[model samples]
Target: MQKRATFRNLWLASAFIAPQLLLVFVFFYWPTAQAAYWAVTLEPAFGGGNQFVGLENFRAVFADANYWASVGASLLFAVGCTAVAVGAALVLALFADRGLRGHRLYRFTFFLPYAVPAAAVGLTFRFIFSPDAGLLAGINHVVPGLWNPALDGNDAFVLVLLGQSWKMIGYNFVFLLAALQNLPRTTIEAAAMDGAGVLRRMWDLQVPLLTPTLFFLLMVNITDSFVDSFALIDVTTHGGPARATMLMVYKIYLDGFESKDYSLAAAQSMVLMALIIGLTVIQFRVVERRVHYR
Candidate 1:
C-alpha cells in the first residue's frame, strides 16, 4: 500500500498554499493578463489613455519586414543553439557516465557554467570574441579580419549562437547525465556481452532508451532559446551591427522600452506567447508519440 499525506483541516491546507498562490497570481497571472489586454488595444506613448483596437497592432507587426527578419533570426538561433547544446551535452554525459578519473570534479566544472548568470557569460564571451584584442585576434594574426564579428553579420550571428549554446550546454549535461545514470544497467551489460563497441552500444542500445529525455530536452531547449536568450543577446551583441542577431524577445524589449511603443511591444509579446504555446502543443502532440518512456 502506498502512503500519502493528507491535510485534515481544509483551512490549514489553504493557509499553507496561500503564499505560493498569491505569488503566482501577482507575478505571472497579473502580468500575463495585462499584456493580453494591451495587445488588443492602443495606448498613448505617454500612457494617458488606451483605445481598444481589434488586431490592428498585430496587423502592423505582421506587415513589418523587419519583424519577419527578426522571426527568421530567432528561428535560426533557436535551432542552432538547440542542436549544438544537446549534441555536446550528450557526448559529455556519455563520457562522464564511464566513471573516468576525477569525473565528479568534471561534473561540477561543467555545471558551473549553468549556475553563472547569462549576462555574465555574455559579457565574458564579448571580450573573448572582440575583434581588436580578443582571443580571436590571435587568429586574425594569421588571417587578418577573418575573425571579426563586430563588422560582419554572419560572424555576429555565429558569435551569439555559440555563446547561447555554451551557456546551455551545462544545463543539458546535468539532465542527460541524470537520465543516463537512471537507465537500466542490465540492458547496457547485455549489449556489452554481445561485443558491441562503446559507440555502437550508445547508438544502438542507449539512445533508443534515452528518447524520452532527449525529446523533453529538445522541446525545453528550443523554447528557452526563444525567450531566455534575450539577456545573453542584449549583453553580447544588442542585435548586432545590422540586426543580424535581433531575436524576437530582444525586439520586444527594444520596441517597448527603447522605442517606447507600448502597443506594438504588447502585441509582439502576445505573438511570442502564442508561438511558444503553439510549439509546445505541437511537440506534445507530434513529438511525444516517438518518445520511449521505458
Candidate 2:
C-alpha cells in the first residue's frame, strides 16, 4: 500500500497554506461577502444609515425592463460567441490536425491571436469596423450609410459578438487541435479503409468523438463571454448608442459606478455570480459523462 507523505511540522504546513488561504479570503470571500451585504441593504438617500431591504433590490432589478434587456443581450453574446467560437475552431482544428506541410506553423499562427490582450483585440476590431476613417469608412463612403454601429443596436451587438468571438476562436482552436490530434488513430484508419470520405469520417466519427471537448468549450465560452466581453464591448461600443451591447457585467458596472445605484448593482452582481457558479457547477457535474461506442 502507498503511504501518504506527512508534514512533520504543523506550523510549517500551515505556513505553506497560509498565503493561499489569505489570497482566497482577500479576493474571493471578501468580495462575495461585501456584495451579499450590499445586495440586501439600501443606504439612506438623505444621510446616516443603511436600511435592510431584504429582496427589494432584487425585485427592483427584476422589474426593470433595462435589466431584462441586459440579460437578453448577455444571453445573445454567450450563445453567439460559443457557437461561432466552437464551429470556427473545430474547422480550423480539423484542418490543422491534417498534419499538412507547415502545419506546426499554421497551428502557431492560428493560436497567436489568443495571446493578444482582450483590450488590444477590441481596439483593433474597433478600428477596422469604425464607421468613419476605417475600412468600413471606405465602403460607407461609397454607400453613404452602408454600416454604422453607432446608430444601430443590432450592428453594435454583431460587432461585439464578432470581436469577442474572434478572440475565443484561437483559445478553442488550441484545445480542439490537441483533442483532434489525440483521437484514436485505429478507429480513424478503420473508417478510412471502410471507404468513408474525409467529411463523412469527420461527421460520422471524429465529431461525435469530440463531444466531450465540444461541450466543455461550449460551457467555458459561454461563461467567459459573460465576463470577458466587457472589455471588448466597452472599447467597441461602450454598451452602445442605445444600450444594445450592454451585457450583465457591463450593466452592473453602469448601475453601481455610473448610476450610483450600489444596492441594485450589488443585486445584479449576486445574480451574475450565481450564474457563473451555476455554469461552473454544471460543467463539472454534467460534462463528466464519457462517450461510449456501441
Best prediction by TM-score: 2
lDDT of 1: 0.88
Clashes of each: 0, 0
lDDT string for model 1 (1-294, tens) is 555976589899899999999999999999999998888999766757788899999999999999999999999998999999999999999889888899999788997788778898888888889888868878888888888777898888888888889988999999999999999999899989989999998888877878777888898889989988988888888898788999999999999999988889999999999999987997787554755432
lDDT of 2 at 290: 53
Q: Give the per-residue Cα lDDT of candidate 2 at 174.
A: 94
lDDT of 2 by residue, 58-165 (tens): 999999999999999999889999999899999989878888899989888897888888899889988888889767778887888878888988877888898888
Q: RMSD, each candidate, Å?
A: 2.6, 2.2
lDDT of 2 at 175: 95
Kindly report which residue pairs in candidate 1 clash with one another: none
What lDDT would each prediction earn against the true structure? 0.88, 0.89
TM-scores, in order shown?
Answer: 0.91, 0.95
